[model samples]
Target: MTISKHIYFAAPMFANSDLRYNAYLVKKIRQLNHQVTVYLPQENGDINEKSAYADSKMIAQADADEVLKSDLLIAILDGLVIDPGVASEIGIAFAKEIPVIGLYSDTRQQGADNQKKLAALQETAENQFHYLNLFTAGLVKLNGQITNNEEDFLHGIQKFLETGEINDLS
Candidate 1:
């Protein structure tokens, strides 16, 4: 809890057809007096917000290199399963010795997933990718977990960024 931090956001991109909670989160982080870089999977779908920021889409090593410079990571681990890309990014952050704070709503009690639904296909998942079901696997390595109020979520991340050792998800 004694270090200044540069935060990087890891989550689903705006291109994701499901329209997860990352956008709202990105907006919140922007409101802060700090700059943050986002890392998400490159998606192929109709997206309006996709052009809003300088997104770091992961497709190779350079993207991973970009992530290493961050002092901390805020991962939106909201998915039926832990998003593979987010997990990988988290791992990379771990390798570089950066702390990761995960935030997610507990809405995993939804329903079955259509494993083959095309992005162009119009369908909806039960909740915001159901983080409840994937909690342990998703956040085992994180320094903190925000499972309820947004204030707590924000505070948790802020604490991690400010101190770097609360839960030590790093």
Candidate 2:
């Protein structure tokens, strides 16, 4: 029998929106008989300092080690930009030659086609995006980019796993 692939999910955990889609993605991956682990840097950032989840050293080491070990990665690329920690894991997974899927959603509005004050911000954001793409091309290049949003957001995960298609949420 074929072994199920282990998918390491990376995304922002600061907002409820992050958890909404992330939880769904994890659930669906599990349904496919694959192991899913979320590498939240914030959750275990103090591993070396010690608290919950094993000792600090162990926690930090395990977090770093798991990304190196996973078969594939599914990342949420929503918000104004991507999370730095998530980007790091994406790079590591890419070096390991694992499949890295990008799931992005822009929750912001168009700003009535761009006000004068917003123009500078728009240009800067565009420039950053270009550099990000150039820097992390391998893993972040993605099989594709997803652009769908749901009331609950489970549909995004469902679509990502089931279709293997990246819907551009631009």
Local error of candidate 1 at 78, Å? 1.3
Clashing pairs in 2: 47-56, 48-56, 77-103, 77-104, 146-167, 147-167, 147-168, 147-169
Q: With candidate 2 superimposed using the best TM-score fit, by how many Å does residue 52's alpha carbon deviate from the native?
A: 4.1
List candidate 2 stretches off by more than 4 Å.
34-60, 107-134, 142-170
Model 1 poorest ten-residue lDDT run: 40-49
Clashes of each: 3, 8
- For candidate 2, write residues 55-92 as lDDT tens digits: 64665467668777766566766655567767777777
Q: How far in Å is the alpha carbon of 156 misplaced in model 1?
A: 1.2
Please provide, for model 1 over 52-158, each residue's C-alpha lDDT reduced to its tens digit, 9 standing for 90 to 100. 54434424454566568776677766656656767787778766767676766545333336444333234565233333434444443554454445666677765
